[model samples]
Target: MNLTQQISEDMKTAMRAADTKRRDAIRLLQAAIKQREVDERIQLDDAAVVGVIEKMLKQRRDSIVQFEAAHRHDLADAEKYEVSVLQAYMPQALSDAEIEEAVSEAISIAGAKGQQDMGRVMAQLKSSLSGRADMGKVSSLVKTKLIG
Candidate 1:
């Protein structure tokens, strides 16, 4: 089944199991997916679905940080729970070693000589690394490799 179908099935499972948190988290995800589809007028493939999940994860992480800074542990915990639920549908995360290797390869392929070519290297890395790696981490690694 596609990612969308899998999410639907999980939502049903969550409802049947009386998992309100899980169900709500998934409903939020589904709503986001549907919104994007409606906005773009295109069906999102698995890769696109993964992109949505990644976006939600980023948002939740930011919210958690802000909530903690304001001493709102309860709100932070809720965001953390959503993050965990969203992460379940993501592709397996790349190891540091693998990410390093991919970054190196992208640099070579893009003919990136220094910081000036950062965009080229990132463009090369983005497609292959998007769902499997954190782009923020990959970008920092690229910058370090280029500068050093």
Candidate 2:
């Protein structure tokens, strides 16, 4: 099933199981997806849905960091729960080694040389690695590869 369909089914399941936390998280995801559709006036495909999920996950991670930095462990833990819920829909994340391999391949494919080509390398990497690996780490690896 497509992500939207899967999420809908999961939402029903969550309701049937009386899973309040999962239900709320799934509802939040649905709201985000619906809001995007209304704003853009276009239905999102699975990839677009995945993009939305990734965006939500990033927001949760940022919130977690901010909460922890402010010494709010309770808030941080709450954000972590949200993150876990959102992560259920994501594909298995690529390992560091896998990410590095992909980065190397992207560099070669883009013919990236020196720091001047960082933008091009980054664009390729983003397209190639989106939803699979952390862009921040991928960027650092790209810089290291280009410089060293």
Per-residue lDDT of candidate 2, residues 24-114 (tens digit): 9999999999999999999999888989999999999999999999999999998888899889898788999899888888889889889
What total of clashing residue pairs does each candidate reach?
A: 0, 0
Worst 10 residues of 2 by lDDT: 125-134
Local accuracy by lDDT, each model: 0.96, 0.91
Q: How many angstroms is residue 40 displaced in model 1 relative to the true structure, after the best TM-score fit?
A: 0.5
TM per model?
Answer: 0.98, 0.94
TM-score of 1: 0.98
Q: Record all residue pairs in model 2 with backbone atoms less than 3 Å apart, i.e. clashing.
A: none
Model 1: how far residue 84 lies from native, Å: 0.7
